[model samples]
Target: MTVSRRAGLLSAFLLPSVLTATTATGAALAQEGKPREVVSTISSGYFDDYLMLAVDGKAKTLSGYYNDGKCRFIFRDALSPTELYQRSELGEAYVVDSWDPDHPDRHFTTTLYSKTPNGYRNQLTLEPGSRDENRPKACRNRISLDRSSWVSESFYDVAVVRKRGARVFTIARAGEKPTPAPRKDRLPPPGTGVWIDRTYSAAFSPKGFVRLNWYDPPGTPHGGYVRQEDLYPSQPLPQRDGGDEAVQ
Candidate 1:
């Protein structure tokens, strides 16, 4: 697959109008005052870009990766009680509210964090069609905590030509030329899900590039590269009985 082709397929599937309903559903889910099981949170670079992995008791796990230390976190319970989730190390605290009344999802709308001047602020909002527009769609983008790594499961859309469809695509890269990876001769249909385990990099890259290991359902895994923009980085909860070191 080439960059041009991937963009074309993404654009074709992203018919705005067609995906509007799906996006709305995710926003709606973020609001419900449901109780969520604590997963894990990983923060980097002044806490601007961070990943929170949580579950709803059921198998459903939601991993949210927000850049600039700001993004809506649809949690079942408030992590703090004093109106702000404060971080003494960063000298900043976060506030929460339901800005979108119509699309309210028990989650805070826009960004609700500020650095204390205690009055200095880093005003940021997650408005519709904003910079965060490229975010992954809920349900379509699933996050999981596998052992110690925060894994993201999503499908790749292969475009169909006159008669045949594409199986491989040239993945996009950050601040560099795209790289082509080996692929299977036969590819699943456009909607077939090709799950990937997101590889993390502590090294900061504005492009949000990540290593994606392709999984054949219950089989082995393959390797690939992708940008972490739409996807969020997640930290796994503290180890259970096994007591393994979590990946950073």
Candidate 2:
């Protein structure tokens, strides 16, 4: 699809009210410690292309490419911890959630993952709105994978602090001054490990900054932006003496 068409489809998927409602639902699910469901949609198109879906069961993630011969888009979703128990199913199954970039607040959970003879597959029932206007009101399809694969590693870059007292900010724009990260979202002590999503790192590269997320001693995740200069490419290991030693 053309870029303009893709943008229009995404815009139509989520109205302001729908976005607010779904975003609230996602937040509630997180607060309740409930497993998150995963879903995906193509907006509008014939289901003839080679739609590939790969699952990393261990990580509870699903990722794949959607190709319609003309255009291709990549999607990945984190699956819920809860499993679906069905009488005829073998192995495990979990709920999946998917969202569009234009309407991040809106999420769908109409897809399901199941173990198959070859490996794993996802069976998805397309949402009414996601289908072409002239197509059937109900649509379903399956995408299978022969093996599980790690997808997160490809999307993030790992780094560690280069010096003590380095700071992270909540936002870092190309031309605007950055806003300091809140106390709760501050970077951990120097030499601690942190990671920045490739998407954010690349987007803010013009500003010489990268957003980083790290875990405090308690294992809680905190994130903020930091200047690229404050980080080193390698993560150092903590030595017995409380200092960090470069990895060989």
Best by TM-score: 2
Candidate 1 local accuracy as lDDT? 0.31
Taking the candidates one at a time, how many backbone clashes does each contain?
A: 10, 7
Candidate 1 lDDT tens digits, 76-172? 2222212222333333222222211113222332232233332222222222212333332231121212122333333211111111243443354
- Local distance difference test, each candidate: 0.31, 0.43
The pairs that clash in candidate 2 are 37-96, 37-97, 38-96, 38-97, 39-96, 39-97, 39-98
Candidate 2 regions exceeding 4 Å error are 1-65, 69-81, 101-106, 121-141, 144-248
| Model 1 residue 99 CA deviation in Å | 20
Worst 10 residues of 2 by lDDT: 40-49
